[model samples]
Target: MENKLMMRLVIATEAILFISLMITYVYFDLSVGFTKQSINYLDIKSTGIFSVLLFSSSFTLVQAEKNYSEGKIKKLKIWLFATIVLGSVFLFGQAKEYFKLLNNHFNISLDVFSTNFFTLTGFHAFHVIIGLILLIIVFILTLAGDFDRPNSTALSSIGMYWHFVDIVWILVFTLVYVLPYLLK
Candidate 1:
């Protein structure tokens, strides 16, 4: 019970941070207005694909948790691995996008829009990294026979964090990627 409560508190705090970052992003973006130079190289289609990949990971994670509860250890491991792969792919996509932006001279140092963009996404990425680490630790513990029906508290906590990360990404994607196009 305490574990669950603490996890919820942590997620709630993280949510506030993300909400603030998003508000700042929108405020700056609207203030500056969308210029061709501001978002010229943003590949919405590619980002959409990446978003799909990340969202699907959440589905896989849910399956993993369900499998664990059902005592299907092998299936749980497989689903957990799938979640990790999907998350890593999403991170790779983010890195690729960042490289492209930097190559095009769009960087955090450039303007308020760029700064907020990077800070928000970068913070989210950091959370993803933390999730990945948690997933990996849980995976190792499972492999060592440390997790069972009665020993799944840590796994459940990590699952909550993973789902939280996915939810935050959806919000960020909508605000940063989709909203700008619609607003324009």
Candidate 2:
């Protein structure tokens, strides 16, 4: 019960922060307008691919939970490993995009678009890294027979967090990549 309550509070607080950043992003977009350079520089296709991978982690996590509930520790570990791999790939994609932007001189300080864009996406990426770390820890613990029991609160808590991170990515991906591309 305490674990769940703590996870709920963390999720609520994080939701507020992400919401504020998203609103800030929209405020900048409406106030300053997205410059042609910014619009043209946005890579919808590549990021969409990564976004799919990130979203898939949520499903893999569910599989892990199912395996845990059925007393299949090895299967649970495999699913968790799959979740970690998918999330890592997504992060790699995000980093690749960041490097490409920096190489093209489209950095955080470039303009309002760049500033808010990086801020919003950077926060999301940070959350992903944290999620990855948590998942890795859980995986290690499971390997050591720490979570052999069915009532694993740690796994449940991590599931909530991982799902939250994935949902946030969906919103960010739509706002940063999809909406801009469609409107342009």
Candidate 3:
């Protein structure tokens, strides 16, 4: 109960952090001159693809939890592993995009747009990394038979967090990707 409460608190704080960053991005985006064309610089289609991959992990995670509940340990491992792969693919897509942006000279110090873009998305990427680490640990534990009904709290806790991260990315993808194009 205590751990779950703490997790909820942590998630609330994380949501606030991301929301603030998003608001800051909107403020700067509206106020500043966009010297670079976002359409040309950002591959929205590829981003959408990666977003789908990340969101799909949520389903896989639910399967993992369900399998665990049903005592299907091997299936739980497979689902957890799928979640990890999807997450890693999402991270890889982000890294590729970051490198492309960097090569285009869109560094953190470039301008307000660049600054807000990097800060918001960078923090998101950091969260994704943390989620990946947590999931990896859970996956290893599952493989080692360290997870069972009595010991499933950690997995459930992390699953909540993983789902939260996926939810945040959905918002981020909408705000940072879709709306801008529509607004343009």
Candidate 4:
């Protein structure tokens, strides 16, 4: 019960964090001119692709949690591996996009748009990195025979966190990638 309570607290904290970032993004966006010229300067296409990848990683993570709950260790392993791989792919896509943006001189220091853009997305990327690290730790635990129990609360908690990260990406994708294009 304490663990469950702690889990909820952690989740709530994460939700608050994302909410704050979203609010900051919206505030900054509205403060500036909503002109097509400003919108066209962003690399929306690359962001769109990264959004897709991040969203897909959420699906993979759900599968991992499902497998873990069903007591199918082998299936859980496969699904977790899939989640990790999808996450890695998403990170790689983000890195490539970042490099492209830098090469094109769309750096964080360029303007209000670039600064906010990089700050929001870069903070998200940092979350993804932390999620990846957690996944690896869980993977190692599973491999070391630490999750052989019939009902592992630790497994479920981590799974919840993984799903939460994915859900946060959904919001990020909508606000950072989709909304900008639509507003443009």
Which residue pairs come into collision in candidate 1? none
> Over all chains combined, what TM-score does candidate 2 have?
0.98
lDDT of 4 by residue, 1-184 (tens): 5656788898898789889988888887888744565456666677677667777777777777777777777777777787788888888988888887788887888777777778877878888888788888877777887865647676567667767877887787777767878876
lDDT of each: 0.86, 0.93, 0.85, 0.76
Pairs with backbone N, CA or C atoms under 3 Å apart (clashes), candidate 4 = none
* lDDT tens readout by residue for model 3, 73-184: 8999999999999999999999999999989887888777777778888898899899889989878887787776645477778888889999888888887788777767
TM-score of each: 0.95, 0.98, 0.94, 0.87
TM-score of 3: 0.94
**Predicted structure 1: lDDT:** 0.86
> Comparing 2 and 4 by lDDT, which wins?
2
Name the TM-score of candidate 1: 0.95
TM-score of 4: 0.87
Q: Residues 1-184, candidate 2: write the lDDT tens digits.
A: 6888899999999999999999999998998898977878878889989899999999999999999989999999999999999999999999999999999999999999999899999999999999999999989999998879987688888899999999999899889888888888
Q: How many residue pairs clash in each candidate?
A: 0, 0, 0, 0
Please give me the total number of clashing residue pairs in predicted model 1.
0
lDDT tens digits, residue span 87-137, model 1: 999999899999999999999888777887889989999999999998988
Candidate 1 residue 130 Cα shift, in angstroms, is 0.4
lDDT score, residue 92, model 4? 90
User: Which rank order by lDDT, best down to worst?
Assistant: 2, 1, 3, 4
1 against 4, candidate with superior lDDT: 1
Report RMSD for candidate 2.
0.7
